[model samples]
Target: MASDSSFDIVSKIDRQEAENALNQARKEVEQRYDFKGTGASIEWSGDSVLIKANSEERAKAVLDVFQSKVIKRGISLKSLDSADPVASGKEYRIVTTLKEGISSEDAKKVSKLIRDEGPKSVKSQIQGDELRVQSKSRDDLQEVQRMLKAADLDVDLQFINYR
Candidate 1:
């Protein structure tokens, strides 16, 4: 039998880099003339970020700032998923989701996807936030990767650690 090739699927972020980007965004907000007096603020709690501003426009501008800063810092924009604006009086708040894990549902979906569409020699298992796929043939594993890339899972995917 041939040796099995395998890889782990994961959604992880470099917390240090993310923090650096956030800090830069805060500094820019403080120095930018338009954001001044707007009482705009950014809050980071656990895996989420909250942006608050006096108005919806300002809130969006803050999001743009964060996006630009993260991009400048070489972070993927896929790391942030922003929610719709919520109004509290004259202020608007938008919660930016920092995706860090693949949920059970997504994991199951990926596992099933691999089982259904993967090469006949490949097998997959859902392990918490990740899906492990393995096959006796390297070509089968490569084909699995190609199939996964074409699947619509609404999440960013990466193939790694193949042997």
Candidate 2:
């Protein structure tokens, strides 16, 4: 009998890499001549990152620098959730949060995609924030991975623990 081949799908970010990117963004914001008098600053506030500047445009510019650093570090932009800058007293602030783990609703979407479009021999089960896929054929498993990667999902996915 052929043994089952399986893998788990998850959405996760490397905290160390994210922090490195944040540090780089902070350094650039502090040293840039234009930012010197703009009161631009970026820093971690609890579990979220805070970007502050004298105006909305300056705050957004700071966010752009942070995003560029994040991309250079090979982190997915989808892992970070940000919203429009808002006024806070005399300065504007943009708060960004690092996203990790697939929500239950998103997990369900992946499971449904597998059940509807994947090879009949393949099976999927949602385990908390991760989805597990199993099949008798390794090729089918690979095919499913390809399909998932091609799907336009909001969260970044990673496959792991294949056996």
Kindly provide the TM-score of model 2 when superposed on the true structure, using C-alpha atoms.
Answer: 0.97
* Tens-digit lDDT track of model 1 for 61-94: 9989999988888767876889998999988999
Candidate 1: lDDT over CA atoms?
Answer: 0.85
Which residue pairs does candidate 1 place in steric collision? Answer: none
Inter-residue clash pairs, candidate 2: none
The numbered model that scores best in lDDT is: 2
C-alpha displacement of 99 in model 2, angstroms? 0.6
lDDT of each: 0.85, 0.95
RMSD of each: 2.1, 0.8
Segments of candidate 1 deviating more than 4 angstroms: none
Question: Model 2 Cα RMSD, Å?
Answer: 0.8
Cα-based lDDT at residue 28, candidate 2 = 97
Model 2 lDDT tens row, 80-142: 999899997999999999999999999999999999999999999999889999999999999
- Against the true structure, what is each candidate's TM-score? 0.86, 0.97
